[model samples]
Target chain A: MQATPALTVEHLTKRFGGRVAVDDVSFTVAAGEVFGFLGPNGAGKTTTVRMLGTLISPTSGSAIVAGLPLSPANGVAIRQQIAVMPEAPGLYLRLTVTENLEFFAGLYRIRDRARIPAALEAVGLQGRATDLCGNLSKGLRQRVALARALLNDPAVLFLDEPTSGLDPVASREVHGLIDGLRERGVTVFLTTHRLEEAERLCDRVAILNTTLRTIGRTDDLRDRLFRKRLLVETRAPLTDPGSVFDGSPGVTGWEANGSGVYEIVVTDAKLAAPDVARALVAAGADVLSLAEQRHSLEDVYLELISEDVEATR
Target chain B: MSGERIRAVVQKELRDFRRNRFLVGTMAVLPLVFLVSPMITLLQIPASTPVSVIHHAVGGSSLLLFVVPAVIPPIMAAYSVIGERDQGTLEPFLTTPIEREELLLAKAIAVFLPSVTVAYGIYFAFALTIRFAAAHAVSAAVWHTPQIVAQLVFTPLIATWAVWVGIAMSVRARDVRVAQQLATLASLPAIGITALITFRVVTPSVRLAVALAVVLLVIDIRAWRFVSKLFDRERLITGSRAKPS
Candidate 1:
């Protein structure tokens, strides 16, 4: 049996003055799934997060966050069940780390006195609990903010650019903490402009450019956007390569990318790789290597955003 | 309305205010500066002073004391909303389960406690100094029953009014300094009303003072409800209201 979705947004739109921030975008996030919301700057990623997090009301349409309808009357109830970590760490610079988390813990009214220390331990900041947030590095402050978000043990955590400006090591630490949350079966709705972060941590990702351009698993998006191709590299140019490669199983088409490099379009690389190798050997081609060409999430994101750039042009 | 949430806001605000050097400087310096004029005025009164002359001098000094509560709270309360926004903390704060009423009340109580304490402290210190140091006629004039009651009752009410004004300006002003300045300017009217009473322009009486305190109380409560309505999440977040799609 399927549990209820953690978030259900239908025709959710937000406009500021004459500009439309998020335009009629709709999506659902399943329970315990790590969903990534990827978009460029001003693509309404934060606006959507703000709408779902109950920080701002939508201009039109509706949503159900953590099993509660999104309305002014239900705003507090919805907020009680979810946590949103905005792009800014937003910590009180003068307050100690424990004080910051304790304040939020008090807001969440988490009766368990142990949760503050537990949250600090979760973020590896137990020793720095008494240190002022202003004294900590940017990375440490982000961790403290994350600990504050974890105070409620929220059912759905909406993280907006959780690793936006961190160093690679700090980013890795945060990624690990996200992994820990996933292991605990917590549903995470992460919004980021970093495609690699989404690719590494998200179960599914939605690409938005004002409106949602596409939404699917990263590999699925890659497959859906570009055709599968096997890259063949030979030591030297081959004579009569067409005859050698013609009628090969799973080889729909072929083209010479360079003198010794051929790009082969294949229905299935597993089926065509062995046949292509045998044909290349039979044709006396010195084959240096043959491998499937893969596309990264960056390529997919750029493809979608570039399309947006083109449509406006 | 969740006492825990209110307590949390109050705790966080007081903690922040305690550590802020500028706020501490303002809270410390303003009351002391306001106290000096009244202390000097009472010290100058002579034993040979007539009853009416002593009454006028005490009334004028009491007006200066009232300015302590009216002015100091606007400075502190003005920082409550715009300060959080200036530091980028308001968004995370609003995302919590805290209602607007709870936040406003907590902020009011936070400023109210310190402002009223300092105001009352200054008042009591002045009274004690008058009892020991001032001439007999001046000390007796300062200890008038109606005057004592007015100071006791009006300090919190005036501070409460200044707080709501300051918070209202904080909600609307884009910058913290500007909010504080405007809130200070806006709260002067509360002092103006007290000035009329001190100068006997409205013919002071026990019934009149009570009626006016009730009126100030009603305004403070309405101001709370009004400021709560003015606290728009969308406007604060985006600096603009949602336009029709």
Candidate 2:
């Protein structure tokens, strides 16, 4: 893909009367990037998506999505390049799945009537196409909605909490579908409360609280904020092998279980682990097992949110 | 603006209307009852009265003429618009290529056309009743160029007004039930007029009714324009405060 950002927000601001939802927020999403927008609810994630999708106009700033300006007149053009899946399933419940597809196909200005059949097949709704939308299960309805969003073969896809209320199986199906989209070079902007979703799907993430808190590669962001903690299990415990080099570096905290195992939390591991082993040997404790606990993405996410909340207060 | 697109939209609406057999039944029953009830009532009128009762019933026909077209069309149009909305607004055409305006307009027509058909059927039935009443009892029906003009010209204008009301309410209201209630509420003026005619509280004058029709025509044009503004898609999906201007 090219180097240019597929989506750009310049000095973006959205104010709802007295309160500002998105305040001077600016970010860029690179071409074909799975850009994750992680924010607590009511952090203007949905607002920003609506503006970028051209559903709502921005209060002050401007956004260029798929190389098209976001304006009502340019709605069709912008919409042609991006598909938006709102928080709810905005569908025609009365129409059968086939009829619903036919309707949206016309809306997208797709003339070939036959593509409708293929589109239904793409979502694995070929059999249910004849069924009324109201009769379908919530998971099935969400699939139909995703199918409609894909009608135009858009370059950018906006999914607003795509799996928020779905069962695990359905959520996995959706995640798999999104993963396939990444392979197909489609840029995805997703707003999700599930931090794991952002961790798994996003190449880069921007944590938004009141404004853009921080934006970067997920691993980089996590490392920049919190030190990596690892969980390791050794075959046997270390029995007082320390005092060989008591002041060793990178290892701050160490504890041992009574069995042939030891639990270790290290900060400066270069000096600490070696000396701790020697000290354990001198103390006559057998080095049977060792283990380190690894910090998770959730740990980083919670840390960031807490930091932001603290800063706001 | 595309013919193909417009045709597609119209077809979707027709599909909805066809599926709503309850609405179809109401359209048939209302028109048939209104048309046949007056004739049946007239047939029972004393046969001993002069056959010239045809001329006398002209007054009744004039009153019925205004009442039938003015009252029924608006309420019927409203009901139809609201009825389609019953399936949760999104449940119907969110996926359709048709613009919201075109969809609303087409639905308005769906509501209007059936209403006019029922009203016209009532008029035709009344006319037939007048013929039968005159030959068998009193020649109460008055045949005049003006009466035909009233039915052909003014009745259509009235139907258009009703369609506008239904469309306006349909777009403004969130669901079918609310739209139907609001549309039904809109016909209060016609109902008030009908009550006046029945009570003889207001004189049965054709000129006043025609004047009301003229005023309604102007308001109808303005309402149509205003209604389209409500279909502001941005405000519909995004909260109104979302847009800058």
TM-score (all chains, Cα) for each model: 0.98, 0.80
In model 2, what lDDT does residue A277 have?
A: 63
Against the true structure, candidate 2 has what lDDT?
Answer: 0.67
lDDT of 2 by residue, B1-245 (tens): 45555566666666666666676676666566556655655656666766445445554544555455555555545544444435434422432334556656665565566566667677776766667564454333334544554565556666676677766676556666566567655754543443443333565356755765677678667866777777654455543534464
Over A1-313, each residue of candidate 1 has an lDDT whose tens digit, in order, gives 1379999999999888768889989999999999999999999999999988877778898899999998889989999999999999999999999899888988888879799999999999999989999999999989999998899999999999999999999999999999999998889999999889999999999999989999999989989999889999998888877897776888988899988999999988888899989988888888899999999999999999999999999
Off by over 4 Å in 2: A232-293, A311-313, B21-33, B45-104, B121-145, B173-178, B187-222, B238-245
Q: Whole-model Cα lDDT per candidate? A: 0.90, 0.67
DockQ comparisons of all candidates to the true complex: 0.73, 0.33
- The C-alpha RMSD of each candidate to the native structure, in angstroms, is 1.4, 5.0
Q: What is candidate 1's lDDT per residue for B52-163, written digit by digit as tens?
A: 8887888899999999999999899988998898898999999999999999999999999999999999999999999999999888878877678788888999999999
Q: Which one wins on lDDT?
A: 1
